[model samples]
Target chain A: MKTQKFLLTEQEMPRKWYNIMADMPTPMEPPLHPGTGQPCGPEDLAPIFPMNLIEQEVSTDRWIDIPEEILDRYAIWRPSPLFRARNLEKALDTPARIYFKNEGVSPAGSHKPNTALAQAYYNKVAGTKKITTETGAGQWGSSLAMCCAFFGIECKVFMVKISYNQKPYRRLMMETWGANCTASPSTETKAGRSILEKNPDSPGSLGMAISEAVEEAVSDENTKYALGSVLNHVMIHQSIIGLEAQKQMEMAGDYPDVIIGSAGGGSNFAGLAFPFARDKINGKEIDIIAVEPTSCPTMTRGPFAYDFGDTVQMTPLLPMHTLGHNFVPAPIHAGGLRYHGMSPIVSQLILDNIIRPEAIHQLETFKAGLTFARSEGYISAPECNHAVAMTIREALKAKEEGKEKVILFNWSGHGLVDMASYASYFKGELADHDLPQEQIDAALKDLETLPKPRQGGK
Target chain B: MSTFSTAPPSDDVQVRCPRLGHQVHFGYCRAENLGSPCFKALDCWYLQFDVVGYFKQTLSGADFAAAFVHQGRPKMQTLVDLIQQAKQGTPEEPSGPGKGSA
Candidate 1:
């Protein structure tokens, strides 16, 4: 195969930044800024968003109703399509029926907008003028920017510097939608200032960006903070994705034997799997797998404990599978999945053994991404490559077993912005790293020090 | 698609620029990468995402009347400057009176 380079020029933004926001319920406990030790409220987030959105962030039970007005706005991309990948099965020479929920059809080119729109809508309803957030690979930032634009809310994004430098087009998409995008650790925030004072050339991390964004939101009165993944409300908003997928599968007259999604902050995976989990709880026999990067294996390796979501304690301590808050993942192309912690809901499900977890190296994941791109004609994000790897492995297993297993997965986002990583991989330049057991053990020890939740209580 | 009449606005103030020497912007600053002069002194926070595009556009456009104009060497320097400025606030521009400046 001929090698291709996907480079962006000056005038074009990635197409993923044109999605709309939908209505979602508010979270119970909003994250607080670590430096100020103050809870981020609706007022702090107003500059970037409308006041109506601020009120929605705190509406706990608002998920019960799907407002007609909101539905009208979301009808453009609300119910994404699910496909049965018969061609993949034919290529693998397996009797297994394969399926995938295509999130790339959405304007943000990922399932992220399913929840971004909801968060933005809720924040706008609450009267917030702006929304502050952090992004690793720029999907979340682009998604939020699209949503904020639709709602006439201002968006301020603190993007991880590595991704900010690597994927300039992603940032452009945010800016095209009128978002004020900054690379973290920005001098605008104290956390950013402290990190810079320590290392003049520190490559910013997602945790650091989260700390900066949280600080900005908590300190301001007109802006309320918004997070893309890993909160009950976020997961709840994302549930719409799975709900729509279930209906699509039913329409196709197919039932999946296994479901797979990649785990980052866990919103996309949860959005694809949670509705299915509801069925499993009621005696549905389905296997669900959450894939993670072996470099930062929060599920297969990290310990289950209470840890601050951000490096600075600007966020609440949630009981989840975490590789210490201070853990800075090695620079990997799959920036979105390099988070040090998994979503609390995903952590709880893994603890209960209701879902399975697997980790793969970057090389293997990228190879799977290449194969899928050749067959499906859509280059998936490196983070979503984890899910593709697991799906391919499961399909191979079915081929060996000569069983007709039904496998389904979520193709989370397109990798047009990640062509550089693919260019490196095809040239056999991709390198993999294994965190030393000693470092893993030390992170585990830190996990032990966190306060445990009371028995049977969250 | 609008053609440049004279020069585009110079909102190219980065948090840190080697030429500017501070985190904040005061007046007409060259973009960290393209040297395309901007009238707005404050760092164009949006440029972080559009650097490649901006460089390509500036190099291709007829706006040679702008501030900085180099091919590739200063592009990386501009990125480095942006990173540095991002970490350290611009000394020239004040951190807008704690909200309500707009």
Candidate 2:
């Protein structure tokens, strides 16, 4: 019988996360302070994050040790299987050997828990009694909730009001994990109150939820805030995915020639690709692709520029990042890849030519999801579909080339919680939407007036 | 905000909101953020119809600029802004149920 899945014992799990900070061909520009316009120091972030994590955020170390307690907790789902997609290869009838690291087996049903658990543990040791975070689709919220339960820390999730109502099951999952989930703009904090005062019926947004969560964390001394992705520390924590993949690939007696993962805020892709990226940086021939929705196009279309972190232009300008200035938001079901900007680390890597970015349409991703489900019998999350879609594209390309290529991708999560998207796809309800060229041109004209970031500023 | 109704031709046209991750109507996207069209409305709805043209025809230049061109901040900036705002908390204490988590 063919060995379908590559397994690693708990003892084989990578103990230290591979940090890409020490490696970059060029050091990344530091995040600046909004008010001071100087590189933001630990004190600025200290208000919301623990000092330990803040240290991790700015650390240049190539390797960071995973705490034993965190490892003990990870034992529940650590060493996730690396599967050889024999069925998918057969279905495609391609010469490419396809493989996927299944991150869906985690308690939260996604790779999000990789960072969530680490954040929760750090917060717990930092004497934080509670952690506050905002979630759009409840993936991060539920993951944090479960980790907080494991760490005995109170988890308060300010979920976007629309998703809070639309995804009640996700909210229930948070509640079941002993986390308190509230509909954002729900009159809980001043931020929520201000929005409610303006529009009583306002279906809240992720921005509104972040405002509320940050407010709650600030008002309490014992509370700290957590962000699921797009931060350096989050990337550091997520490298475990790639580190483990490396060991499992060795066990399978094969190395991937191509590595793919979907990039929303770029953490999960960085999770699976950064360690492999080290190899690519050191003269190894590997194609690392970060797949994003065509609508968002943070890396694929947007030019490298300094842009304000928020729409309000309050945050300091982030350098070497693609401003999602011309977002055409094609209303794809891949909700996670919709973040306005790519992570600074991921952005810098792109600038240095260490990573490649690709964008695909909504229909292509959904179609690839269906093909994967039919072949592998595992329905993937809408976000995961982007990677699968890109993987299939590469496989077909290899077939046409008549080259025996090895491909690996991160199966970031399962789509069980996101069946509504599938229902929409099956019912032919999903449609493409894009911005008019005139509108994009008009918007870009105004963006010129904004402050440009200093190249590699101190 | 002018009362010129920026309603879509058909209220039935719907698309999944990238931000919210669910189906929302053209009506909802147009007036998503307290009477203003979502900043991403033009970006999200142009393919369905002449969304940019419709808004250009219906809205004042100021309103139009506010909606699409001046879309809100990125997620990180919002957190930084909130921390500053929370530090300068207004006198009013939050009147709500206690913290919800265990």
Candidate 3:
């Protein structure tokens, strides 16, 4: 019998988070200040984030210390278990050895707490009394709420009204953790009020919620806003995921040949891959794949014109850049897959060809999720399903080649809260919205005459 | 040809919204982008309900094509735009006086 689970003692937890910025082969450009169109500095971010976190955001120190206070909080869930997917291997009848770092075991039932605790601790240190944020699915909100409770800081979450009313469990979790959850468009701020006055029945949107949250944060000096993903600091805080996995894999006496993580704003994926990316930078040959949903196309395609019908059709053809609505696929059950952007760090890495980004279809992701749930006995969050789908694809490829490849992926979260998506899949309600290859090809042909999009500028 | 029911799921039925990255209801997806249905509404709600069929039945071909077919800038780009808009204390969504200007 082979060893199944690899556990790291609490003492073995990494003390510093890896910052890939210092190690990137080519440095990434800084985010531009929306108004000035110049590289944004710490002062630009000071309105919402604390000085400490902003320092981390701009720091390229390669290693940043995990504060003792944050370490104590992380100890409760740090050193999350790494397990070999022996069962999944048998189920797939593959020769590949699969390993997954279980992030679902965290308090918020996702990997979010890994950074939530760190962000909360930094806010506390900055003398912030309250934090304001917007939540789409409530994962980040609940995680921050729990961490804020531990730190005795007030948390105000402006959840989209639709989710506020429909998905009450995440809100309930936030309330249980002592955070004040408000439905956006609630007349709390001018932004919310403006939308509501226009349409009294507005269902509320993430954009609206963000406006409300940022308004509250900027208005009150003691209140700072926190984002769940898509920032360098957030990715830096999440690097602990991969750091621990490195140690656990050492114990298992195996090294992964391929690393896969589903990318949304890219924090969770970055958390697990940046450490390995460092090794790759130092001449280690490894396949680093960032999985994304086909629904949310990012870092995948450039501007192109697609005619509605066939390869020969030319009448209805329009440049996607001009129309602003070329092939935006339908939304998927995977919440992370819906995000239209990748983290700047991840985006830069893709540009450098250090990381490969692949888009998986909605139906295929769900199918992989079910296969994973049945064999691994843990249902994955829809976002995590993309990684599972890719992993299955890689494992099957290894089988076809008769190779015993080692594969590792981040099990970002459990799907207990997302069982409804699985239910829809079982009911045959899910569909794939990927455009046919011919349509895409025809669209590309038309792009040669169109105006080119500005690259890497605000 | 599809086996799934064309009837819409109850208003309470929620799926993880790809645009917002959270679970949202059919009610919101239908009209969240102001009075018009969200551009992704047909693509998103197709699974839970006969979203494409429903939209086809309710909207003219041009309107249906307009709502779901034409696309916008990437969400990442939109987010960057939102940050600028938010800094200027302007609402990014097209509501109120901001409608049509966007």
Q: Best candidate per TM-score, number?
A: 2
Candidate 3 per-residue C-alpha lDDT over A282-329 given as tens digits, one digit per residue, 9 for 90 to 100: 988889999987755555663422222211222222112211233334
The TM-score values for the models, in the order shown, are 0.67, 0.91, 0.84
Residue-wise C-alpha lDDT for candidate 2, range A1-458, written one tens digit per residue: 99989999899989999889999887877766667778778887788999999999889999999999999989899999999999999999999999999999999999999999999999999999999998867888899999999999999999878778788988999999999999878798887888898888877766667778888888888999998887889999999999999999998899999999998777889999999999998999999999988765667766566764434565446663554454454445666676666777887788778889998888889999999999999999998999999999999999999989999999999989888888888888776544345645664564676766444323
Residue-level error in angstroms, candidate 2, position A379: 0.1
lDDT for every model?
Answer: 0.59, 0.80, 0.75
Per-residue lDDT tens digits for candidate 2, residues B6-61, read 44557656777666666667777787666677777766665555677788888898
lDDT value, residue A265 of candidate 1:
70
Q: How well does each candidate reproduce the native contacts, as fnat?
A: 0.00, 0.32, 0.27
Q: Is candidate 2 or candidate 3 better by DockQ?
A: 2
Taking all chains together, the TM-score of candidate 1 against the true structure is 0.67
DockQ of 2: 0.26
Arrange candidates, best TM-score first. 2, 3, 1
**Residue runs of model 1 more than 4 Å from their true location after superposition:** A1-63, A159-166, A182-216, A307-317, A323-332, A434-451, A454-458, B1-102
Which of the CAPRI classes, incorrect, acceptable, medium or high, describes model 3?
Answer: acceptable
Every model's DockQ, to 2 decimals? 0.02, 0.26, 0.25
